[model samples]
Target: MKHPNDHYYLITFQYLGFRYHGWQRQPHVKTVQGMVEKTVNYVLKDKPFKVLGAGRTDAMVSVNNSAFQLILREEVSIDKFFKALNENLPPDIKALEISKLSDSDSFNIIQDVAEKEYLYYFTYGEKMHPFCAPFMTYVREELDIEKMSEAATHFEGKHDFQRFCESSDSQDDFVRSITTCVLAENTELKANFFPKKSYVLRVVGKGFLRYQIRYMM
Candidate 1:
């Protein structure tokens, strides 16, 4: 064991966001960060440490990758800690890696993140399976895939999307860079109606402001 003063870790992870509230701690809804703290503390048998995340993702928005930092008083083998963590962590949130980060009084992912991506899935015409219930959005009317695809192309590069973003949880700076946004037809896509078209919208960017995907689609 090492002195607690110098010990710290930068934790990287990914999760399925369907089961928990957005990242931040809330009164009622469970949160990803909350679960990580509780499970880690459980591993430590109640040793307390502060859990800090780079950015807080809203509910139903899955994280393909993310980072957080925690300071500790003791040194622990990374492999063993991760093994125990995987055992304690729920199916939704899984620790991908643990690395020591340079000591800094303050850490923020927003400033350091080079790029980020958000994928939104949807199908029109019919429902293929219940498994996609969480990610798939079924539309009552068929959206022109070509038109939508063309619209997506229009979003590439940086643009002021204030007019496009939905009217929920809006904030200043609607300008967002769209490195790539496209609509592609899903094969053999099924829906409530017979023989129809289906498509999924995949958008990648430096970052998304908020509800930007819904507005783009």
Candidate 2:
């Protein structure tokens, strides 16, 4: 239940997940949420607050855009808070925007999401430059791109994805719908150190179970 004094805000941020364990806060481990809350606490000067992420990402998985909900006991100067939040956050993480949420607003970050898109960048045959390790995956053997592309289409539409997900005993439903799944030549990201030829597996869905994308790839 929300306290009468509680002030709710929705914050959008992005992070390079290469260094953090994941999004959730865990004991004695660095995570995106851990760092974010730490910085928030610092900026708020020990003011009571709570944060909840829209969703969690796996270790070493980077995000171009993501968000979280922040609940505070006291209101803040939005411009000053936004500026300070970005300045204090680590270089790999950035605060994009912050907006106040009214009490009557019907927004639940976790449940209201329309869809999520994931891009798996990769290259094969030749080893990638060391600099590319953080952003791209490397496969030692040459891959049959055509075959992979064709196979990606099979995952489109609603289907039981139990084989592709890591589920727990408490969870029985494994069905998921894929609005888009395609493999294509990489044109989205370009770096001078990146390989001359590369590819990306783009997957879009309402939700994904843990390790589903990794297993699918």
Candidate 3:
């Protein structure tokens, strides 16, 4: 049941997760959610509201597109709120859009997600610029790109990923189908400080276990 004065809205945004610990709010720590909440409270003059992220990102993991649900004790103009929110949010974080949500929308972020894609970027043989640390992992050891590329296919299809995941028993199931798993030359993300040659491990599936992607890399 909806509360008398409560309203729900969906906010889409992106953030560079390097500075913050992660997306979740924690006491006495800088976090993406904490920054967002602080800004919201500031803009709304300390109005009561709660923010719920669609998913949590690990430290230093950037996101291009993500969403959060905002529950407010009172209604507010989305246009004005969005404008104010963007103005107050940190430079690394940006609000892309805002939309009102209703009971009939049939959207449950956790359950309705059809699939998720993860890209792990890395450059081998040399240390990358400090700026690239947030966007990609640097590997000092030399790697056989062709061999790694072929091995990536082994992770495709369904198999027991117990060892690759953390706390396998925490979940009801261990088998996961990686619809797309491959290693290819890095082309998706570009930066002036990035290495001339880099590769990315692309993985896509219905769901992922905690730290599964990192372990796979």
Please tell me which predicted candidate would have the highest lDDT against the true structure: 2
Once fitted onto the true fold, the runs of candidate 3 whose alpha carbons sit more than 4 angstroms away are: 1-5, 168-172
lDDT of 1 by residue, 61-100 (tens): 7886788877676667888988998899998889888987
- 59: Cα error in model 1, Å: 1.5
In terms of lDDT, which candidate is stronger, 2 or 3? 2
TM-score per candidate, in order? 0.82, 0.97, 0.91
C-alpha lDDT of all candidate models, in order: 0.76, 0.93, 0.87
Residue lDDT tens for model 2, 1-217: 7788889999999999999998999999899999999999999999999998999888889999989999999999999999999999999999999999986258888898899999999999889999998899999987999999999999999999999988899999999999999999999799999999999999999888888999999
After superposing candidate 2 on the true structure, give the runs of residues whose Cα lies further than 4 Å from its correct spot: none
Model 1 alpha-carbon miss at residue 149, Å: 0.2
Backbone collisions counted per model: 7, 0, 0
Q: Write the per-residue lDDT of candidate 3 for residues 23-138, one digit (tens) a residue.
A: 88988879999999999999999888988888877777788888888889888999999999999999999999999887624677667667778889999887899988888888
Q: For model 1, state the Cα shift of residue 113 in Å.
A: 0.5
RMSD of each: 4.3, 1.0, 2.0
